[model samples]
Target: MNRLTIYTLFSLFLFTNCNENAAEKSLFSASKSPNTAQNIILLIGDGMGISQITAGMYASDSILNLERFKSIGLQKTDAANHLVTDSAAGATAFATGKKTNNGVVGMDAQLKSAKNIIEYVKEKGLAAGLVATSQIAHATPAAFFAHHPKRAKMENIAAQLLTTDVDLLIGGGQNHFEARKDNRNISKELAQKGYQVNSFMTKSLDKIEPNYKDNFLYFTAASLPLSVEQGRDYLPLATSFSIDFLKKHNSNGFFLMVESSQIDWGGHNNNSDYIIQEMLDFDKVIGRALDFAEADGNTLVIVTSDHETGGYSINYGSSRKKFKTGFTTDYHTAQMVPVFAYGPNEESFMGIYDNTDIFKKMMETFGIEK
Candidate 1:
């Protein structure tokens, strides 16, 4: 055989062996593929730890929406300046693929701006949406769209929403927009910008149908929303509505974030019953996202948390009927959290990694340059 034929055969042999090797390590493989997801649905159960999930599973008669995921991984949760992480720092890692000091949002430790996945992907004509059980400008949800030096700058964060072209938003924080510290009425500004801004004060979430031609925003409460047990159960339906609206807004693709925001509050309160209620409600939201992802077949669904809170632990003698639990601290812990991925490129999440890698993997899955 000539040199050209010999080179071709050797390349083919190497390629086949590489595939065989990757197939052998399917569970932990990180090899890049040509396939890309048309949509990414990220579900964050804030402050949800293994013990919390266990308690919820038992409380729900030993069932959970998370059981549907096959690809699972662990992630180290720590801040740039401390061993333990707060929600803002932890969320910044996922939003910008970098660690920042606690309480900082969308900016780096040195206070430089970083383009979040939503902002970067929008350049490619992809629409985005956010759904949360907390205020829309709360740390976890706000990190996905707004940038600020501190997460507590709710008024400034609410004002920053006017700069983003995000398609849909469903959460609370009517006070931030309509009643602000700066005395600016952002909701009216949004209306002038052709956004259909509505809230619980005007109509219930179930009754407000978002108009696809205009951007949609719905506030569930005048401020922070109630807990799941207090008859606050709008998360699942809001997630479903967001997916539908974003899909219509951009047929090319979309990114959606659904947060069970109050799970962390339960941890802070050291209330097991509260955690269980929020956890169960979050699972329903997960089921809703999974249903959409499975039907679309082009969507990638990821479920994880920024950090574990309460250092929660399950006690012995616990049964599906009832359980005993304990907490090490009434605050966030320096523990590794679990990562679960489903749909296209799910295997990419099957190994232990840093929290920032999740952002990289999502960008990679969407074939977007980081």
Candidate 2:
């Protein structure tokens, strides 16, 4: 063959091979890249241990919203100062990635404040919201936005809510804000700060449509809210409403923390029926969150508990429709809680880890450092 013809053929062969390899590399890249979610919905079922979940599933005819999750992990629940962690400290570990003392909210062992994931996300221009069945100033909810040495300081926690950038607030504790020892009308102050504040006494959640142009707040009760069995029925609806409100409030993205707060109360009371009822209610809310995430395809839904309560267990003679349960204690226990995640980057939550890793994984999902 001629020298020019030989060179041309070799160059052509090289180009064809390069093009084939590039196509293969492109396919590999698509499969390997993390499917990061645009929005995150974190659902905290306080004191919901494995037994609690099991009981709920049985009571629901062997079905639960949690069964939808494929990515599951176990989280070690221990406080900085105790083997058994309180909701405040366990939630603080998840919020700030720091293991604080029991009964402390958003503060470390030394009473120093730690910046929570919500604050970090808000600083990045993402909207944040909090919803719970308990008082808004309760330990689990308060840990995300308030810093206090003691979680019992509901009045102080109520004051801190007025200073937060949270776009939506739904729960109880109206009395803490309106009839405080300091006589500070926090609800009025919230309205003055450009929030559209409403209450169960003034307007039901269905009556008040959320407007993203202004912040929203809905007080469910004067103190603690009623249990699901006692006529409280807004949790599932509120979950759906908050997701819509937050998405509209921020075009970039949003972070929402929803709590089925009374599950712990049921555990504290050692009432199996109460736990099952609360669990079923929380499951409905989970279904609502999963519905939004599955449809959007850009939302991550994480469900977990701070710790186990009551050392609860299913006893003998339990059927698929009924649970014969027993409890070892009436307070919190040093038990590993289950974590179930779905949607983009859900795989990151798999496997056992510390409670604080929940915070780390969430930050990594958002491409945030420290």
Candidate 3:
């Protein structure tokens, strides 16, 4: 009775404990799986590489809102035809989940027009908005709403913007819309489309309270907006305002793309101070987005860059208070960029992937098929 009974009881005890542990593991995994987000806020810092973020962190006394993000990933920034990606292709990858040739916007390498995330969200009854420090018709922001083959076609891009169902548009480039060669005023056309079109020539953004009932468009400049160092202080404010306005405008949810567009320009100019200033400004915008996501609990905030510009690097002898920076070129380089994500489905973004995966991940996070 001793050996046989003891062996049988020990085997039974081991089987029961293993079954209980398996059940607990399954429950934990389900709880941590990606949950759908009500709102998705994508903040793109153009040409914001690791060096740019490091410089900004050092310049800002070693504190960055990016550090608050726990899920981070690296994205390969290559266009369909080139190793070094331009903003148009880079942004198109994020907006459309397609690898297009360099200089293409909202289209693939075969010149096929792709539906972007903004249009997809709008079709699903979610409001869409774009905020940028550059012209609204610029490559990055335009990719979200326009389908132009060439990024240089600002006039065409502006025209396409008038056709989209985007709820809010805040940036520069009023001339591309109103002062067109066709002698047509797109602002009036936007007004006809039920948008409250205002410009820097008429009213400042800080003074006017946006009405959520009507779509809003505020051109910050006639052409390209000024740099942050040139007293362009509206990025953070625009970010905060756009989030609130889009939230109020749409009952289901909203998709907003905010771009700190000038950081790439700084890299192109090989200006270290320019990069640092723009980087710091973009960090503030990220902080505002994080604050909203933290409070809303149903919002997903994804921060990343299209590609790395200027081949930027933080050199040796850099201190926590100062950054010794260097640049390899004046244009964008073939390098992978970093992606930081927070809120719902943030875990999906924590790995190495293609740039187009951003659009896929965001769409998945919103529970949108395809």
Model 1 over residues 165-246: C-alpha lDDT tens digits?
Answer: 7788888888999887788999899889988988888798788867888989898998989998899989988888888889
How far off is residue 115 in model 3, in Å? 1.1
Query: Which segments of candidate 2 are over 4 A away from where they belong?
Result: 1-35
lDDT of 3 by residue, 120-157 (tens): 89889999999999999999999999998899999988
Lowest summed-lDDT stretch of 10 residues in model 2?
A: 22-31
Using Cα atoms with residue i matched to residue i, what is each candidate's TM-score against the true structure?
0.90, 0.91, 0.90
Clashes of 2: 0
**lDDT of each residue in 1-370, candidate 2, tens digit only:** 9999999999999888677763354344334655665688999999999999999988886578899999999999999999999999999998999999999999988899999988999888888999999999999989999999989999999899777788899999899899999988999999999888999998999888777889998999999899988989999999999998988888778889999998899999999989999999999999999998877766789999999999999999988867788999999999999999997789989999999999998887776777
lDDT of 3: 0.90
TM-score of 1: 0.90
Candidate 3 lDDT for residue 46: 96
User: Quick one: RMSD of model 1?
Assistant: 7.1
Ten residues in sequence with the least summed lDDT for candidate 1: 22-31
Q: Distance (Å) between predicted and true CA of 302, model 2? A: 0.3
Global lDDT of each candidate = 0.87, 0.90, 0.90
Q: Spell out the clash pairs found in candidate 3.
A: none
Q: Model 2 lDDT vs. the true structure?
A: 0.90
